[model samples]
Target: MNQLERLRKYTTVVVDSGDIECITRYKPQDATTNPTLILKSVLSKKYDFIVNNAVQYAKKMGGSISQKIQNASDMVSVGFGAEILKYIPGYISTEIDARLSFNTEQCIQKSIKLIDLYRIHGVDVSRVLIKLAATWECIQAAYQLNKLGILCNLTLLFSFAQARACAEANVFLISPFVGRIYDWYKKFCLDSSYDAVTDPGVLAVKKIFKYYKKHMYQTIIMGASFRRIEQILELSGCDRITISPDLLEQLKTQNFSFARKLDATKIVTVVDQPIPLSESEFRFLHNQDAMAVEKLSEGIRQFSCDQIKLEKFLLHTL
Candidate 1:
């Protein structure tokens, strides 16, 4: 079996792309789309229809320019997600606006709105995972949404505090960014070469996986933002892995053997103390971690920029 085929035996591979062709080719169990990906897809020829349709719908929407832009943005996001769902049998994650990352009420409202748009496109809410930044308020919002039978994907997760909060909230899934963590460490390292087994990003997810399994937290851990194939291979037995098409394709051609690195059935020897996830504690702990604080803020800012650029692109199509 190729790497992709072997990897699936240990993990549910998810295609992280906005292009339908990529999703169709890899046949990932699921697909994840973000503002940056959607923006890229909107510019492509094959998926431009989604953007054009959203623009037409927004022109008829009854709202101010700001509201129209917001509606169009949501439409484009769900539109891409809904289309991607047609190819994958599992859920498709549609991210909420990064600007709403810190606002609990707004995140909830936007999540509901995104689901409603999915409904308009004939997609069920259960098949959708509303992606939110892993803020304390956003975790609370996800907690509420999960209770209402609206599943969520707590994204942009970096620290142990964020992972613990998401697990405590019983979120549908949590996307711990693997590559972004590695990026920070590499930039700070005096020597360039880093071992995949010792990679900060890989170790971060391993820690979260062990914690979740030790306590038997039902939340799914889907490692995201992989920068290397070794990073993905290292987290082989994770609940799910959201990988880019480029990496997925790379894995498909390599004829190498891989083994599961994480096992839920293994003895839990790690410290399993329950971490405090109060609002103050979350902020304090997050602030203490230099990498988490810097990367979390940077991720939000970068996604917000892509979202604004997407809104502008849609405005032109209007």
Candidate 2:
């Protein structure tokens, strides 16, 4: 069997894009889209209208770039999520701002607000996965949201501690970024590691998977941000892996052998403990994790900037 088919045995492959047409053709199990992906899609001739609508809506709102951008981001996200839902039966992940992650209250409020907005627009809440940074606040928000019947996908995770905390909180899913971890390893060269199978990012996800499975943690682990086919091949047995549309197509066409890399049954197990985090504890813990703190902040800025440029491109160029 090809690597793609082999990988399917252990992982549910998800298409990481906002392009509904592409998702329809690729036929991934689920789909993931963020500001970056959405913005990239909106830039194309086929999807440029989303940006125009977002800009017009922002213009009607009349406020600072931050406020207008928030409005515009919502417009853009709703457009992609609603349309993408037409192609995938499983949940579509829509991200909340990484900037809001540090504040548990805001994260909780924004999550509810976004879900409410979806319901108001007649979108099925069951088909949506609200994506958030894997910061303590975001996870805390997810814990509450889960109890209230709203599922979430925790993103931007890098460390085992972050995974442990996320699983402990009973969050619905956690996305341990594979490519970013590989990027960090390449930059630092921890122990002079440079193997395809042992890529740092791949290793990070493996550790999280082992920890989650060993603990019998109910929280699902979805590996994201893959820079190479090697990374995806290495994470074959993860709960889920979100790949860009082009990569998914490449996987479908390119013939390669893939080995089963992760098995929940084979890993040594740990007692499952359900530990809920208080608001204060959540804040303090997130503050302690410097990697999560920096990445979340950086993701927000990058997304927001894309939002601005997206609007400008739509208004002027489109």
Candidate 3:
């Protein structure tokens, strides 16, 4: 078997793209997308139909320009998600707007509306994982949604506090980013000894995974934003991993034996009690870690920027 097949023996591979061809080629169990991926996809000729359809649908709706933009953006997200679901049997993570990341009520309402769009397109709720930024309020929103049987995939998670909060809140899954963390360390940290095995990003996920296993938390830990196949390979045996098509292709071409890097047998113990990550505690923890604070803020800004660009593209399509 190729490296990808070997890796799948222990980890659940998720395609992190909206490109239908790559999804077909890699055949990952699940797929994920956000404003960034959807924006890139809408510009591709292959996905023009999705953008055009969303624009046409929103034009016929009775609403203000701002409302229409929101509607069209959501439609495009759902449209791409539904299309992706056609090929992957597991689930497609459809992100709620990043702008709603800090507003619990709005996040909950928008998530419900997005799920409704999936159902309208004949996709089952179980096949959809609502993606939310792992802010304090969003964690609470995930708790609310989880109680109502809606699964959530919390993104932009960086600090241990975020993971703890999400797990405590009964979130379905948390995506601790590896590549972005690595990028931050590379740029700021003077210690250049960090390799894939000791990569800050990889270590972050490992710490979270160990803590979850030791505590027997039911929330899943899916490592995200990998910069290298080495990072993905090192994270083998994580509950799930969302990978880009480029790295997925690299894994497919290389041949190697895969070892299970994370498992229940290797439980990680926390020295202290479960961390309290209330709004105040969350803010304090973030303030202490400059990397986490900067990365989380940058992540939100990037996603929100893509979201605005997408809205404009949809509006222009009219």
The alpha-carbon RMSD values of the candidates against the true structure, listed in the order shown, are 1.7, 3.3, 1.8
TM-scores, each model vs. reference: 0.96, 0.86, 0.96
Model 3, runs deviating above 4 Å:
268-276
lDDT of 1 by residue, 1-318 (tens): 999898899999999999998899889889999999998888776777787778778889967888778888899999999988999999999999999988899999999999999999999779999999998889999999997789999999999889988888889899999999999989987875888899999999999998888888889999999999999999999999999988988999999898889889894655564765788887887788899988999999999999999888766665
Order the numbered candidates by TM-score, best leading. 1, 3, 2
Best lDDT among the predictions, by candidate number: 1
By lDDT, the candidates rank as 1, 3, 2
TM-score for predicted model 1 compared with the true structure: 0.96
lDDT of 3 at 6: 86
lDDT of each: 0.90, 0.78, 0.89
lDDT of 2 by residue, 1-318 (tens): 666777777789898888778899878889998878887787676876665676677788778776676767777787788778877878889987666767888988878877876775589898888998876777778889998899999988876667877888888888887777666657755585567677877877887887778778889889898888888888888889999876776787877776778888788776755465565766676678555556656666787677566656544522
Candidate 3 has its poorest 10 consecutive residues by lDDT at 268-277
